[model samples]
Target: MPNYAESHRDLDSYISARVPVIGMRTIEQQRALRLVREVATHPRRSSMPFWIYTRATGLRDLRTNAPLQEDRSLTGAMEYAASQFTARPNATLVLVDPDDLEGDTPLTRHIAEVARLAGNNSGSIILLTDTPVWSGLQRLGMSLQLDLPDADEMYGVLAGFLTDHQGIIPIAWSEDDARRAAETLLGVTEAEAVNLMATVAAKGSVDKDDVPALAQSKDRIFSDLTGLVKVQLKDADYTVGGLSNLRDWLRRKNQLMQADLRHTEIRPPRGVLLVGVPGCGKSLSAKAIAAEWKLPLYRLDMGAIHGKYLGESEGRFREALETADRVAPCVLWIDEIEKGLAGRDDGTGVPQRIIGQFLFWLQESRSRAFVVATANDVRSLPPELLRKGRFDELFFVDLPDAQDRKEIIQLYYRRYVKAEPDPDQLARLVDLSEGFAGSDIEGALHDVGAEVYLGGGAEALRPSFVMDTFANTIPLSRNNPEQIEEIRAWGRERAVAAGRTAGATTQGAPGPARRIVFMED
Candidate 1:
């Protein structure tokens, strides 16, 4: 990155010289004016340098001395400049155009013509375009670029914006927030910033709490550039019980935020991967992680991102990543990730390329957006994704054991009945749910409830309702026993079990046993 002082000085020097052609790559009108002034006041190499200013909309006559008329083209602008400097003979000609000259057909061609016109006049011409336009103008020979706002500039801009507001006072923004926002909005022009602030202020009293929303709104406003949508975690309640060890790990992560405030390079905690049987709360744990982190959750639906148009999928993924960075200190949940990015045998490399890009961003991103990716089959995932440093931990969610099943039953009973179910009835239900996952157990409860409602009322229903539900349902362990055992055996050596076992604690105490739960098929 060029130093701020160097960039500013370079631009200043470029503007001050009576060069035949000068190009400025920036979006701010004020900065462009500053550059023009610097060049106009510099020691003149010639007695007169004609100034030709061109814009899509003609310059306003602030003096109210004449009616306003649009120049519409660079050729017309040059004529106007000649008229303005007729008496000076060797006057400088400054051409100012709000539209990027490269994109404007006639204007670009006129640039060469204008240069010829100022050949012996000791005049200068300046072209100004927004950042987007500048990228296309790279081939147009040496030009000056104004540096984006740094941390200090952000502070000044934010402070000034706040001071000018007459509504509720804005709270002091943290350095981290300011730095992150500034970097994410780097190429944004001053006018864009002002517009963002105005939109934010219009909704509510601008404060610290409102910053996230403002940032989200800005991301949405630029949705074409940042394709991301807000996501909500619906299963936060699942992490409350039977996952003590995992919860403790999460708690420790939260503590790290306060450990050393002075350290500026603190890495945001990389997230975890939950892999195991279907409905074993892998997805639920992702929701819980977001809740624990106290951040907004965004579910990156790969299906939504995949497009029929060539290269569109990759573009969408990049946009999503950029948006995630823009709205930092958030969570990105990529559910069923293995299936989402699986490459086909066909020669199309789009999936591979898109996944590669995603992983690269995951490893190098400086944003605080935590990524929680869940998958059912590890064998299908690319090995590079599972390597150390990609995610902090990988957990295996096996079938919930007997003890976990008991807890699941109690939790659901209390939630649905507002009281404990009969202990004997609950015991029987747990016994029958041996190899079921949390989701299966919930389904069983739903079946029992449906039976009770059909039979007339709660009085007519008994433990038999649950027994019948169990009898009617088929356990997944029976059909996929080999797969289940393979997962468990593989997890024994590699992953932390997400279940309650013989060595597990029941009083919500954290232990070494992988937290697990059993469900009815």
Candidate 2:
């Protein structure tokens, strides 16, 4: 499929060559009509006789809306088209949305017959449809697919649509606002765009604040699409205690991610990979990114992609990725991606093939989909996936340090204990949770909250009870010291630390620095 400009040129070339049948396939019927009119009214092709037919409009002059016939049925329209081809040379007939042309049926064969007649007279048959033409009819001429408007072309389409409502609606949009709205409304059709604007205008005023409504409207069209789960974001879900380094990086990238980069050679920032110890904030970071950036979040469920039949697994994975692309300017969270792309195959090679397909899409896709993939086990990832440039950066999420634990404790303390944490008590709690991950701190706080709930209210909450909750629980680092140490060692060596640099480096620093220099001139 070509862009609008390319499609126009190809349509013009095909019509000039007297391609007896031109199947213009598109979901946008109005846009297709406008394109046909533009081509028909061209100076070089201005003299050619052009007519259009719809069930409601019957047959009419395409350039002017003059009725050519009183017949209102498709049968009647095709009957009239057949006679016109033989009677008039260089006559073009546009059949708008004719049904039953998907296979070589009676109607398709009839269309093929009319196409042959048109060919003899240097005329053409234009089928304006969103369906596939029968092979018999398609053989008579060529077909071109008109994809949805790109951002550049969409600006014009949106501006034109909005111009019609100027006097009636109080539109508070400038050129920049319109461009922003147009970019957000990229995936929907021109008709849908107009309808959405109309929907917004129906609310009594059209202002800059209503621009986001356009995106909301566009999203409604694809609300029920398959292969993705729409994650409902909660403010609490993004409490995100630490990872200042990751947070700062994401904030900077968000600025570039949402900007207009079509004219510039610089590509939008792709995404990041967070791999580290379990129960750290890697998973929550996905939610935080979406909340921070104000974009929709979709969790790609790899567990759902596996199928009982051959090829079904690959098909599902592809569908999931395609769905993500369709809903652009969104965050795609792949939690524990190692589990999904591990290089293990049962007698069949479905898993291997899926990995290849995934990498190709991730590398080539220019869509505004920011992928946030997390993994607990860095060792399980395929080598190709970890190569440079796969993601914008690779971040390692270590366990919450003393500073991070203090913040996490204070955050959940406010939520659960209904009070600000005492700074001195917080210091003690932080020390107690030295090896605790963000999740471990959250879990401990959650227990404190639960205990307060069961024991009447926050008034009855004992500081010792909260202290005991932190003291009694054995964190993951304590349960499997070897495994946690191994993960921390790998992260320290290979990945960018997600927490602040000081918290990241001060942990387990090599003891006793030595000086080797003596008297080198």
Best by TM-score: 2
Tens-digit per-residue lDDT, 1-521, candidate 1: 34345666765565455455666666466766665555555555334343434454454332221323466565565666655444344455444544445564565655655554553454555666654333233333347766555445654666577668755745455655544445434445555666777776776666566555544544444434245556645553435446555667778876553233234666767677878777777777767766665566678888888888889989888988877765555677889998878884537788898878988887887656778788887778887887887887877777777877788778766655445778888888877776677887877777666666687766666656567676555556655666766666666667776554422212321123232333534
Off by over 4 Å in 2: 43-47, 66-71, 161-174, 202-214, 308-310, 344-347, 501-521
RMSD after Cα superposition, model 1? 6.7
The TM-score between candidate 2 and the true structure equals 0.89
Top candidate when judged by lDDT against the true structure = 2
Give per-residue lDDT, candidate 2, residue 273: 94
- On residues 1-521, what C-alpha lDDT tens digit does candidate 2 reach at each position? 48799899999999989999999999889888999999999998877999899988888999889997777788888888888899999999999998898997898898889889999999999999998888888988999999988888889977886798888878888887888777777777877877787788888778987765565466677777566888988869876888889988998898787677778886767789999889988988999888877778889999898888989999999999888877777889999999988866556888788889888987888777899999998898888888887889999998877777788889889888778887877887887777788888889899999998899988887778777777776777766777877888898888899997422432422233222222212
- Model 2 residue-pair collision total: 0
Give per-model TM-scores.
Answer: 0.73, 0.89
Error of 2 at 259 (Å): 1.5
lDDT for 7 (candidate 2): 90
Superposed by TM-score, candidate 2 places the C-alpha of residue 106 at a distance from the truth, in angstroms, of: 3.4
Error of 2 at 381 (Å): 1.7
* Residue 463, model 1: Cα distance from true site in angstroms: 3.1
